[model samples]
Each structure stands twice: as structure tokens, then as C-alpha cells.
Target chain A: MLDRDEDILKAAESWAEVDKGVALATVIETWGSAPRPAGSNLVVNEDGTFLGSVSGGCVEGAVVTEALDVISSGAPRMLEFGVADETAWTVGLSCGGRIRVFVEKVV
Target chain B: MKLATLSAINTERAARRPVIVVTDIGNGEQRLVRAADIARDPLHIELERHLRMGKSSVIEVEGRELFLNVYAPTAKLVIIGAVHISQALAPLARSLGYDVTVVDPRSAFASPERFPDVRLIAEWPDVALPPLNIDHYTAFVAVTHDPKIDDPALLHALERDCFYIGALGSRNTHGQRAVRLRAEGVSEASIERIHAPIGLEIGAISPSEIAVAIMAEITAQLRLPKASTA
Candidate 1:
């Protein structure tokens, strides 16, 4: 249950309470053979430690890098990844799916 | 996505109360909705629908894309017996993500060896169930057959408004149980909710099959919408 959505949110809250720069990434839309459903959360701290998944490790590394930038910038970002998209070249979803993730700092 | 909002959502979840975090994905504007306040919200019907299904989805409202992230408590299964059927039922329910607990007052019947990794409580229902906070999210089953154990547990389950309350018995036995419960002052409406002769009509003949049947029924109750007059 530690990896469940509830626990992931709990980690976000605890990380933020301790003054750590925390960012939350959530899958807001998906199509084709998407691995995770909408509302799947990925919580990341300033140290790049993350819990949960949005694309089942297919795009988590890229999302974490973007999340770190979001944490520092304090600005939200909307990210889109599809098998046919330009950004898919480096971190392609092997499942051949499309997912839109919203990343925001947990201020 | 404020920290205060995140903390509040966690508090409601820890209390086993359903909560929703509505995020307007267009701008990252967010709002938290508690269970008691769902009715007054503008999107009450859609909110209740997702909450009941324990699902999260994106919906468009007035051209704004909102993600309704429903945070429902983990569903629990309280088995009032550690009988043969429960041995199978506990593991099956756990596989479906239910926090399964087996209760029986008989020490010999409620042993750790029989129910591995399950929350085994070798105490009477009156002693064991209250602390579990059997809420609307819980699915309660009384499979002990002994009136002394099953009856009280069932009464408590009804009182707590458990989404599913089932008792393992034949129709004939259910008839007798009806009389006993009526005598104990349980209203007719409450008694009608119990799925006596528990489980789906799967024509199950074995203990494992019966467990499957019961779990199937529970899944429907948790996920499917009720027949609506509206």
C-alpha cells in the first residue's frame, strides 16, 4: 500500500511540510495503449527522490528532470508525450501510448 | 496543488472519509471537496458518480478541463468467521485490494496458521469490530453461522451503513434470522439490505467457488451504479 495513490500524496504533503521543494506530477489524460490511467500521481522532492508513476517508468526519468526544474522555477508545466511526438524520440513510451501530465510545485 | 490542500486531503483520507481534489488542468487551479459538501457543489452529480466508482477522470465543464481525483479510503472486508470459506475469502479479497480482517471468538477457529497474513482477531465481534471503524467503505460478511457471532456482527454492520452486508446462510436460515433480527428491533428497511444466501448466483459448489461468488458481488457493489429511479 506504500506505493498507492493515497500514500504518494501523503509523501508530497510530508515533503512540503519539512520545507523541501516538492513537485507533483499527475497524468491528466491518456489515449491509445496508456499504461497508467488518468490521475496517477508522481511526487518528487528537491533531491529527485520520487514515488509513484505516470507512464510505468517509460517517462518517469524525463518527468523527474522536468519536475526538478518546476520545483526551482515555482511554475506549473503541462507535458505531453506520445509515440509520434517530437519529444518521444529520447524517452519514448515503449507501450506506444500517449499521456499528458501536469506538473506543479507543492507550494 | 497547495501543500495545505494536500495535507487536508490526507487528513480526510486517514479518517476514512471520501475527498476529492478537483484540478483545473488548464491552469493548475485546484479545490478540495469533502464528503459532506459534495451535495452543494455545482458538479455534485458527476462528483458523486466518480466517488462511488472510486475512479478518477478528466471532465470538461464550461470549457475548463477539470481532473476529478477522487480519494476514496481503501475498501475493507470484515469477515465474521474464520471458517473454511473465510480461509479462501480472505486471500481473494486481499488480492482485490481490500484490507481483510477475520474475526471469531473461538480461539481454535481463529488461528494464525489458518489465515496467513490476514488480520486475525480472536475476540467477539463486539470487541473486535468497533475499533476497525467499519464505515460505508467497508464490505461486511457474517459467515460464522452461529447466531451468537454472526447476528451481532451483522447488526453492527447495518448500523454503520456498510455498502455491502452479506450473511452466509440458506433461504430457510435467513427466514429464521429475519425473525431474530426483527425481534431485536432492526427495521425492515435495514434487514432488506442484507444479501442473505450471500454471494452472486454463480451456482458455486465449493468453498473457493463460494468465495469467488462473494467477491464478485462485493466488486459490483463497490463499482457499479445502483438502479436509479431518476
Candidate 2:
């Protein structure tokens, strides 16, 4: 229950050091029965290899896709997903909770 | 985040020290705060509170939104006895994601047959504790109720500055323990820190209930504000 590991963050650093584009997506906020807590991270490399979870599996694919864009542009973006959002059907949290993720590239 | 900042955080985590990354979500600016540097940081109050809670939180200051992502070491439980209480306490702690270790000098008590899938050290506290590296993240419990075993283990725990130090004993038993510890050069303040009547005042009569009480007290010690004790 309490096995929180920072291995993903470590992987993010090592990938960036090897000159690979790395993007980190963190759950900055959560509301009403979120699967993951705020500050949960998902690290994505240039090849879309990802570690960790911001919204369990419900929104990781979407976050990884956005992370690739952030890695290329070096611009951070905030993505929100939930039943209440317009993109909910596409990448909404199936757990019925809303989460705001902050996606940023490692420089 | 900068590569240097990320590397610094990984370094601190490798050493098992608490660190926080304060991020400015508005502009994506971020800075790393090591445990040793938190007291001097501009947001020391917020950072210390979040670290004590072992949680990450978002706060607003000066019209800016900041997310504090705390990376604290996993809490460890060092049980100095392999008795009934330890048997119950070990599994409970493990379920809570704590690194639980039971140390008893007696082979019969520390047998793997009795306590399965747990780290059982059949060695004296002096030999067992040093290598365990008990620190502020550890909760040390002396439940052997034997002065020969519990006293030295508690002394080592005190020296290590464990976040929680508890012993399974009544007020009368603890009074005598205090005298013995004082004679051995432990200060009055340090002795006072030990929870003599260990666990919450829940009138726990069974080993399982006592384990729950102890875990509850540890949870309070970990998550509650340092100033709030009752």
C-alpha cells in the first residue's frame, strides 16, 4: 500500500542526460475520487516510453502524447481530464475524478 | 525542470533524505529544496508541513500557484522483540508499506518458522541496530519488556533520533526503566520523549488491538503537526 518509488524520476534524469528528449507529466490537482493523488508523475522519453502514472491507466496514453509535443516545443502545458471535461470521452478519467496534469520538458 | 535540479533531487533521494520540488505552475519555474535547506527556504513553513505529512500539496503565495512534491524516505519500523506483539505488529506495519525489522537476540524467538517473510535478526541490539541505520524516518519499539534487551536498544534508538520511540510497559515499569536509563547517562529530556505507556490510550487488551494502537500512534506521529500531541 505504501510502496511509493521515485524510480520514474530517476529514469527521467538518466534519459535526459543521454540526450534523449524527456517530458514529465505531474498531477498538479485532483478532485472527487481521483485514482491517483496530486503530485503523481509520469515520465515520458522521446520514444514514448513512459513510467509512473498521473491518472492510473485512464489518461496515461493521452499524457504521453502531449508529453511528446512538449518535448519537441520545450513549452509546458496543463491538461485536464474528467467526466466533466469536453475531451472526457477521448481521455477522461474512468474513475469519475478530475485531474489537472502539468506537462514539462527537461532542459 | 533543469537537469541539474533533477540530478540533485535524485542524489538526495539516493541518500534517503527528504526533498521537495517547489514548482511555479504559472510559468513552469521550479527549484529543489533539500531537507537540510528547508529551514532556510522562503517557504519553510509550507515545506516543513508537507514533509512532516509525507505528502505533496499545492499552495498559492503572492498570487502564484506552487506545487510542493515531497519525496520522503519510506518509514521503517524496528521491533526490538520477537514476542506476540511483534508478530502482530510486523504484518500490520508491512501492510502499511513500512519496512519492518524484528530484532531479538534469542534464536528461538527470532526464528523464521515463527515469523515468515520478515527480516528477523537474531543478534543483540548493538550488532543489529547499527547496520539497520535507524534515522528520523524510523519508529523504534521495545516490546521485549526485559531491561537487558529493551534498555540498550532504546538507548541506540535515542542516539539515532528515531521519530517515534515506544516501549511496551506500564507506568510503574516505565518508572524503573527511567531510573535505569538515567543511571546509564540518558538525559531526563530524552527519557521523557519515550512513550512509556506505549500506543494510544485505547485500552487495547489483545496483541492485535495493541498493534493497531501502536500503528495509530505512529501514524499520528508521522502525519500530525509536530506541535499537536494528545
By lDDT, who's the top model here?
Answer: 1
Show where candidate 1 strays beyond 4 Å.
B228-230
Mark the regions of model 2 whose C-alpha exceeds 4 Å error after superposition. Answer: A1-4
Give residue B50's error in model 2 in angstroms.
1.4
What is the C-alpha local distance difference test score of candidate 2? 0.91
TM-score of candidate 2 against the unseen true structure: 0.96
**Tens digits of per-residue lDDT for model 2 on A16-93?**
999999998988888999998887889999998998998879988889999999999999999999998788888788
Residue B16 in model 2: shift from native, Å? 1.7
Tell me the whole-model lDDT of each prediction, alpha carbons only: 0.92, 0.91
TM-score of each: 0.94, 0.96
Candidate 2: residue B108 lDDT (0-100) = 93
lDDT by residue for model 1 (B125-185), tens: 9999999998888999999999999999988998987989999999999999999999999
